[model samples]
Structure formats: structure tokens, C-alpha cells
Target: MGTRLRLTAVATAVSAVVLVAASVLVLALFQRQVTDNADDLATSRAEDLAALAAAGRLPDLLTDIGDDSVGQVIGPDGSVLAASASLGAAPAVTDRLGSEDPVRIDLDGVPDDDETEDYRAWLVTAQGPDGPVTAVVGTSREAIREDVLALGLALLVAMPLVLLAAAALLWFLLGRTLRPVEDAHLRQRTFVADAAHELQSPLASYRTQLEVAQRQDDPAGWRAVVSDLLAETDRMERLVRDLLFLARQDSSASAMSLVDLDDVVLEEVARVRPTTAVDVDVTGVSAAPVRGNRDDLARLVRNLLANAVRHASARVQVACRQDATGSLLVVEDDGPGVDPGLRDAVFERFRRGDPARGHAAGTGLGLSIVRAVADRHGGTVRVADGGGGARFEVRLPRV
Candidate 1:
């Protein structure tokens, strides 16, 4: 069965066992309390009757006894002298009698009753007008039985409902707890598949070029094949490097320190200026300090600059400044802006925008890496309209 079902079943079974044990314990205690209370009441009544009999003040009918109880004062000859109204004209409730200590007996019913009702009787002996006599008192057991039966029925009805509720709550909490894990597992699978697909292209091209170079007898033709092989090798190397960087991002525990965000931005811009004809504007740059791994932050800045330079029509603008919330960095390119539908998807690994936006030379992982670095630094990145082209913004917390 599924994990949630298994967990719920185990938890419910434990609850059922505990409930059963607790119910049995409570029932046993209740039965004992009820039985003890009845015995004490019967004993007290018998003692009072025995005192009256000793004083030679016994009457023909006993008084002050409960309606469900029976009392009898028996003579030495076993003849009933005084009896409670419930047992009118009946013989002694019990023949056993003791003088030093009270005798207790369980009987079906009194002599005159037709129905077999349960009773607890206490017998005590005392001196009477003629000689020694006995005082017997019996209390009905129906009330105690009724009380116990009511409690048992209540628990029988409530236990299932309680278990059902507990199971439902447990299932809901387990689902909530496992959702993120399931999502991460799905993402990992997708990432592996995409990485394999991306690598297969370069590998196939490299093998084809090697085979072609093996057959080429002309030195110039061999040179052409070697160049093609080198280009494919370079492509594969870049893809591998990007993949390794992403893998490390998942498990890296890099230390953090105070770094100037604007300085990183300026350095990346200066490095890229020599490689591209796109104009790199640094006029908007300002000192923006943040606390994070300096190398990762530089990578973030580098990726953003490279993406802009790769797509920009002629000029690329870079800006960095401290804001009320934290540090804000923006990069805008004047090339065809990202399609509105693919803006969010661009940050996803291996995701590329429309071909019209010139993604031919890009690895598609640069934007993904930019997002990963921003996220690792407890920041956010988003794409917006840069007036004429796409604007990428990165926000990080201030030191």
C-alpha cells in the first residue's frame, strides 16, 4: 500500500489497542466501585437492625430501608420477626449468621419474589428478647449493571469515530510533508534527461568529424576536420562545465562574506567588453554591499552580462545600487526582447526562448545559473520590460 495508508493504518491500530485497554481498565474499576458501595450500604443497614434487636426494641416491620433493598430480623429458631416492606411475609434472606463478624452472601432473590433478581446480602447476629437472633440486609444489583452497560455502549459508539478522525488528520499531514520531496524528485529526473539530450549533439558531431578526418588524405582537408572536432569538443566542455556548476550548487556549503555588488558588476562588464562589440554602460553602477559567496555573486553578474551582450542589438546597460530592501542589479539589452510566455521558463534549466531572440550561441544554462546563484544568496531574479528590450533584475539582501 501507499506510504500514507500504511502510516495511518499503523497509527490507528495503536490507537485501537490503547482505547481497548483503557476501556477495560475503566470498566473493571467502575464495577469494583459499584460493588463496594452496595456492600457498604448493606452492611450499614444490617448493623442498625442488629443494634435494635440487641436493645429488644425490634418491631414487626423494618423502616428506613431502600425500596430496592430487603431487611429481616430472624429469631434463634430461624423464624422471621421484622422484615422490610419489599420482602413482606418472607423467611430470612440467608441462614448463615455470625456474631463476631458480618457474613456476606450473593443470592438470586428473596423467598417471596417470582423473578430471579440479583442481590448482595449481609448477615449479622445479636441478642434478642427470646435469645440470639440475626439481622439480614440485601441490596439489588440491577442499577450497577445498568450503569456499566451504559458506559460500555457509549465507548463502543465513540471509539470508531475518534479513530477515523485521527487517521484523516494523519493522512493530510503526511501528504503535506511529502509534496516538496516529490517535486524535487521530479525535477531531478527532468534535469538528468535534459542534460543527456544536450550532450548527445556534441558527442555525435565529434565522432563524425573524427571519422571524416581519418579518411581525409589532403592536409588542408584534415585541418578542416580537426577544426570542426575542436569546436564540437569545446561545446561539450562548456556543457559539462555548466552541468558540474549546477550539481555543485545543489550540494555546496560555501562560506559567505561581505562583498561589493557594484564592483562585481563592473568587473564582469569590463571582462566582457573586449569580447563583444556591444557597448557596456557603467554610468548607473553604484556601491551596493551584500553578504554572500563572492565567487557565486560574480558568476551571477557574469551570466547576466553575457546574456545581455549576446542578445543586445548594439548597447548593453548594467546597473547596481543599494535599495531600501537590499541590493538591486539590472541588465537590459536592446535586442528582440524575450517572449512574454517564455520569460519565466527562461530561468528553468535547459530552457531557451524564441529563436528570434538569438539563442544560437547560448548554452541555455546561463540564465538558470544566474537564478540559482541569486536563490542561494537568498535573493530573487525576474524579467521585465527594459523600455526597448528585456530587463533582468537581481535583488539580494544588504550586509
Candidate 2:
């Protein structure tokens, strides 16, 4: 199972165990409390009955004890003198050991079918007309059993529902908590596959070129081979650099300082203007200060430029402006812009606009890096809408 599910299961199990233990403890205490109260009441009433027998008024007070009670007054010879209506003329409930303090004992009568009875008795020796008599006060345990049974029933019925509700809540919460982890896992898988694909072509080309050069053994041929090797190495190095940059971003933050968007854009424009046939426009550019790492902001501009330089048919516009909201950097190309449907997909890692026409020997991570920098700086990057060509825009908050 996944980490989230395992954690939730453990939590649920612990909660259930604790809850069950607490319920058992509560039920046991309830039983003890009820039984203790019953014993106390029975012993007190037995004392009253013994007092009446000693005063020679036992008969008058005999009916005073409730019918639910079973009482008997016995002479020292173990013969009954008086008894409650519930146990009329019954023999002594227990052998009254000559003790002043009350003694408790269990009393069972003839079993009725398979059902048993709830009987608990208390015996005490008190002063009587016949030297000394024993008073037995026995009570049914039905009240205590009923109360305990009700609690047991409640626990049995409610525990499952409580656990089910807790499980359902945990399922939802764990899903929400692990959603980002799942996304990152999928992203890592995709990244590894795409990185391997990008590196494979360069390694294979290097191998084939080296083999070709070895067969010829010509000085001129080896030079050309070395040159090609260098270009391929450069390409691989750039890809590795981009990948490392992204990895580092996940681990820590870069130093931040105020930066001018115009300066960064102008520098990137100057660096690329000579390499492309596309006509570049910088008339719309302006200075807009913001807080960010200069290197990352510069890379963001370079990637946008590289993207435009590779795809634009004739013209690419680099524009910058500042507003109440933030600073905006807009790059527009005069080629067939990104398909509106694929606009969002274009910024994803390892995504390509056109493998045949626009890959441009450049890594597919260029736009992804643009978006990452924008995000790291608490900014946003998006495709601007203007109908004809692709318009990419980056918005960064001011310092």
C-alpha cells in the first residue's frame, strides 16, 4: 500500500483499540458502581429489619419492606420468625454465622428452564426477643444487569459506525494530503524518461562519429569529427545544466535582489539578434524593477528569446511594461503561434512545439524553465491572446 494509506490504517487501528479499551473500562466501572450501591442499600435495610425484631415489633414492620425485597428473621436455632411477602415462610437464606457485622452471599433458587435468576443476599445478627435473631435481606440483580446490558448494547452498536465515519474522513483527508506527492511521483517518472531520450541521441551520434573518424585516420577528418563532438557535448551540457537548475530550485532558494526587467531583456536580445534571420523589435521595452535572482530572471528572458528565435518566420517582439499589479514581459513571434488548444501544454516540462520545424536543436525544457522561474519569483507566465501568432507573457511582482 501507499504511504498515505498505511498511515491512515495505523491511525484508525490505534483509535479503535483505544476506544474499545475505554468502553470496556467504562462498562466495568458502571457494573461495580451499580453493584456497590445495591449492596449498600440491602445491608442498610437489613439493619432496620433486625432493629424491629429486637423491639418485638417485627410483624408490624414485616410488610414495610417492599415486595421486591426478600427478607427473613431467624432465631438462634435457625428457624424463621418472620419473612417478607416475597419469600413468605422461607427458611433462613443463609446460616447466620454469629457475627455482628453483615456478611454477603449469593442465593440461588430452583432454576426456571434455561433462564437463571439474579439473587444477592446479606445476613446480619442483631438483638432479638429470642436472645439473638438473624436478618437476611436479599435483592434481585435485574436492575444492575439491565443497566450494564444497555451500555454493552450501545458500545456494540455505535463502535462500527464511529469507526466507519473516521475511516471515511481519513480517506478523504489522506487523498488530499497525498495528491501533490502523487503528482510529483508522476512528474519524476516523466522527467527521467524524457531526460534519457534527450541524452540517448547525443551519445549515439558521438559514438557513430568516433567510429567514422577511426576508419579514415585522416587529420582533417579527425578535426571535423572533434568539432562535431564538441558541438554535441555543448548540447548535452546545456541540457544537463537546465535539468540541474530545476532540481536545485526544489531544494533551496536563490539570493534575491532588485532587478530591471528591461536590462535583462535587452541583454538577451543583443546576444541572440545576430544568430537569427528574424527581425527583432525592442521599441516596446522599458525598465521595471522587481525582486528576484538576477541569473534566474536572465534565464527566463533567454528561454523566451530562444523560443521566439527558433519559431518566428520573420519578426519577434520583446516588450516590457510596469503597472499597478506588477511588471510584464511579453515575447511575440510572427510565425504560426502555438495552437490555442495546446497553449497550456507548451509550458510543461519536455514538451515540444514542433519536432520537425521548431525543436531547433534546443532543449524542450526552455519554456518550462521560464515558467519555473516565474513561479519561484511568485509570478505567473502565460500565452497572451492576440489571434495571429503566439504571444508569451511573464508577470513578476514589484520589489
Best by lDDT: 1
- How does model 1 fare in lDDT? 0.83
TM-scores for every predicted model: 0.83, 0.83
Q: Relative to the unseen true structure, what is the C-alpha lDDT of residue 218 in candidate 1, on a scale of 0 to 100? A: 71
Cα misplacement distance, residue 191 of candidate 2 (Å): 3.6
Please, what is the whole-model Cα lDDT of each candidate in the order they appear?
A: 0.83, 0.82
- Quote the lDDT for 329 in model 1: 94
Report the number of backbone clashes for model 2.
1
Q: What does candidate 1's lDDT look like per residue over 1-399, in tens digits?
A: 276678778988998999999999998898898889988998998888988987888888887778777788887777777987666665655456546689987766555355657778888888766787888888887867887898889988998898889888878887788666766666677668878999888888877777777776577787788788788778778887887787677656678999998888888888999999889998999989999999999989998888888888898888999979999999998989888888899898877766678756767899999998998999999998777788999999877
Query: Taking the tens digit of each residue's C-alpha lDDT, what string does model 2 give over 1-399?
Result: 388889889889987998899999999999999889888888998888888778877782266655445677877677778876545565746455558789998767623246655568898778776688778887777757888999999999999899889988998898898987786776677667777988999999999999888888888888889889999999999998988787666546899998888999999999998998899999999878989999999999999998987888898998999999999999998877877678898888778874433556677789999988999999999997854778999999976
Off by over 4 Å in 2: 10-23, 51-69, 73-83, 110-116, 124-134, 169-188, 255-258, 274-277, 354-357, 397-399
- Candidate 2 TM-score over all chains jointly: 0.83
How many backbone overlaps does candidate 1 show? 0
**Candidate 1 residue 287 C-alpha distance from true site, Å:** 1.9
